[model samples]
Target: MINWYPGHMAKAKEKLKENLKVVDVVIELLDARIPFSSRNPKFDSLIGDKKKVIVLNKMDLADKKITDIWVKRLSEEAPTVAINSLNGQRINLMISKVKNLMSDKLNQLKRQGRRKKPIRLMIIGVPNVGKSQLINQLCEYGSVKTGNKPGVTRGQQWIKMRKDLELLDTPGILWPRIDDEEISFKLAATGAVKEELYDSELVGYKLLKVLKDIISDTLEEQFDLSQVNNDTLELMEDIGRRRGCLMSGGKIDRERTGNIILNEFKSGKLGRISLEISSN
Candidate 1:
């Protein structure tokens, strides 16, 4: 079970609600690999009636086919764009999409003689979904500091994106309660949730189990395993032995092996993997 409800997150929740009142649009960044798990459902109710854009980030680290499907499926609700924010891949297209989505709103402002003001935006997402990276790409500078771990952006920072656009960067907000096991595992697996909150062995086992079915070939290639097994524990043992993680009695060092599996998957060392499939 993954239980992570820091009291500080409540403050961030309030901050996002307050920031929404001033911004013209909400640009939500989600991990391309775990779109369903990464999405904070609270956003729909919190940013009510605000123009929203869905950015499927880390596209290169997710399955291209599923990412495409997600873009199409989510675009029905909001203007959606798939991008790898780390390298700014197709980030220009994202900018263009934002402009197009906001054109009607911008035109209304122009008619009211409000054309001189810059476009104000609020970016929110579950932790570690490339929110800061997208901000840097958009601003064309490393404005907001970024890190691999969650809870890195503890405070809100207002960043100017060129002369005509401004952004408010709030701490990434996750729903207070995550009841679904797979959602919990995916969030934990993607490094969106803090590592200390969940057990590494269980998460690694679940991740390995999923990959065993979805992308066994990738696992085989990465670990040089000639044969794969149905049980994640056995698979983990094989991986541990391959990686030379052993103890005095030559037992598989499960802790070290778990960390290795998680780190490799999170860093995309195993290959492009997507945890969620489109329901539609």
Candidate 2:
């Protein structure tokens, strides 16, 4: 039921298709915490036959065991590496993977005695998946605009990482429609979809429900709860009361409480958590 496809995203997808004709390798960035939901399903067609290196950005905020499972599973499809773009963790490994994917093509060009060309890479992903931060780390400087919210990068621009590396940074684009409600909530919970498009209280409630199933102990400890109540609304209300999100009549302010839970989860204050895990 949650759907948000801005007009710009449509145009961005077209631009991405056009730009793909010139790039040699595609860098598909994904959130380490929500890898499955963060992936734009349209990519399988959009990037057909192109060499790809999947970089699981924000590994620092994801559960290591789950992330490792994802890395292994996704590697069968394409070269993948888990990295924290903010601090450049495992960035070298990603670079190595990218180079390895292009090795055959580069060698073929060399055999023809042609001039060497910089490897052109197009970085694509959903918004707020750390694409810009990953570029900044690659360039070792702030080469592109970045923010914690979705839809920050709106246009395409080329950034030269080195003499042999050129990157095309594009706006994060989502599919025209998201039919799966659970996927929609996961996207919202992980900050992929814009906050203005969904109800925060509903997302908070859904997120609490998921945490209760997978990380009840950590959630309880973080919020100082004696025990996690099975009723999600009651759990949220308890959190609201503990965090002092009270109204004039001592009622729990649902909106403020929801935002508190969401912000804490996004900021990793709830501890390293992964909402999605590899089925394998």
What is the alpha-carbon lDDT for the whole of candidate 1? Answer: 0.86
- Per-residue lDDT for 1-280 in model 1, tens only? 6667677788889877887889988888999998988999898999999888899999999999989999999999999999999898988787777778678877888899874567788888988898888888779455778887888878777788963678888888888889998789989999998888888988998888888998888889899999887888999999999999999999999888888999999898988888888742
lDDT of 2 by residue, 194-273 (tens): 88899999989888888787888977888899988999999999999988999999999988888889999999998899
TM-score of each: 0.95, 0.95
In model 1, the Cα lDDT at residue 166 comes to 87
Deviation in Å, model 1, residue 266 alpha carbon: 0.9
Model 2 global lDDT (CA atoms, 0 to 1):
0.88
Clash count per candidate: 0, 0
lDDT to native, each model: 0.86, 0.88
